[model samples]
Structures are given as C-alpha cells and as structure tokens.
Target: MATQTLHRGRLIDHLQLVVNDLESSRRFYAAVFDVLGVPIGGSGEDYFWADELFVSSAASRAAQGALTGRHHLAFQARDRAMVDAFHRAALAHGGRDNGAPGERAYHPGYYAAFVLDPDGNNIEAVHHGDADRSAASVEISF
Candidate 1:
C-alpha cells in the first residue's frame, strides 16, 4: 500500500463507542490501529479517537447516554497480512476472537478478520483485494 493511500471507510461520518472501561478500549484500539498504520488522532480522559472512529467512556461529554449495544465496525486494510496482524493485536490487547483471519464469501477477494472489542462490539479489519482509489482521504483543516 502506498503511504498516501486512504483507507476509505463506509458511510458513517463518525462513530462513538461508549465502553465500560475506557483504558482497556484505548489500549485495544491503539494496538489495532498501530498495526494497520493508523494513529490514535487524540485522546481525553474519557476517550480516544482515530480517523472516523471514537471510543469513549460513559462519562464523557460527547458520550451522551448509557453504554451502547454491540456495533459492527469494519475498517479497511491494505492486504491480508494487515488483517491478520489486526486480529493478533486486538487479541493481545484485550479483544476476543470473533472470527479468524481468512477470505469471506461476501464478495470476490474479500479477506477479513473479526474480533470482539473490550465492549463486545464486532470489530473487523478487511482487505477488499487489490483496487485503486482516486484520493487518499478527505482532509480537513481548522
């Protein structure tokens, strides 16, 4: 994958996961993203974020309600190796194996792995085989 490639995410603008334990969630995400070559954009006492996903404690101001139910979040991976690494990192950092890394019948060349995050959300890292993109990602400036 090119260093400039953007892992195009799905339709959601931003998704917040209110977890029971913020630290565990943070560690879990940190590791997973690290292997996928994404960084934790920023963090607060009750939350940590990356690109379009945010994980927060129930007490955070942005985390307006009780803990959320299980959500299926699929992140784009550059290849099958990255998806495998994602599973290993998640499991090593407090996640549970939901599904092993392998090809799926969802479509041709769809390789993915699934893990249950600290909060039991179904998190996935997938590589939709080789493809091309027009731009890396959408950039915003303040």
Candidate 2:
C-alpha cells in the first residue's frame, strides 16, 4: 500500500477506540481510510491504527479496563468525491449507513456522509468545499 499522511490540526493529538473485535474494526477502518488517502499507521495482535485514530481489543493494556460508549468522529475529505467513496467503501467493509452523502446544513458547501462502524461509533467523512491554505499542517520539531 502507498503511504499517505493527513494534515493535523492542533486540537487533537490522538484518539482511541476500544472494540470487541479487533479484526472487524480493522477491516472496517482500513477500507474507509483507504478512500481518504490515509495509510494504516501500524497494527499488532490486539490493535490497529490509521493516522491518529487507534483501534484496539480489550486485551490490549491500553484497553484492559472497559469498552467505551459510542463516539462521533469526523475525518476531512479532500473533496466531495472522496467522501462518497468513503461511504461506499465503509459499507462494503462492515459499516452501516447513518447518513447518506449530501450537503449538510452545518454550513455552506458542507458535503458529508456518516457511517456507524462495527463498534457503533459514528464516523463521518466531510468536505468543506474549497479554500486556500497557507500550509496543509503545522510541523512541530522536537
């Protein structure tokens, strides 16, 4: 697979979801992320990650306590076409449709699609129209 990286904003460093079945979650996310042009970061026997989102089984030390409730996570899509592709790919790989692809009332040119992952997390792919940017993301050097 080709390597792809997403530009990160300052607010979120990372997010994790504790899932009942790691394999199922892996398949679901892998297919969706592929459409968004992001590559899987890595994986282990109990965990798999893409970009800043980590999915792991309860057996992993980071998820040994309890599984979390549903959460909403939205990923930025490069364009409306990518958002549509993401929705289709997600459904083909164990995701259920929460909302179909279309313009949302959130704001002008807010095209998005929502899907429920294997663990019932509300995942979304959104395109905020077109805009100019100084840079894709800010790079912090350690």
**Per-residue lDDT over 57-115 for candidate 2, one digit per residue giving the tens place of the 0 to 100 score:** 88898987679879999998999999999999999999999999999999999999999
Misplaced by over 4 Å in model 1 are: 1-10
**lDDT (tens digit, per residue) of candidate 1 on 21-136:** 88888889989999999888888888888988988888888878588878999998999999999999999999999999999999999999999998899999999999998766
Evaluate model 2: give its TM-score: 0.90
**Top-scoring candidate (lDDT):** 2
- Which residue pairs show backbone clashes in model 1? none
Local lDDT at 137 for model 2? 73
Candidate 2: where are CA atoms >4 Å away?
1-10, 140-142
TM-score of each: 0.90, 0.90
lDDT of each: 0.88, 0.89
Candidate 1: residue 112 lDDT (0-100) = 98
Most accurate candidate by TM-score: 1
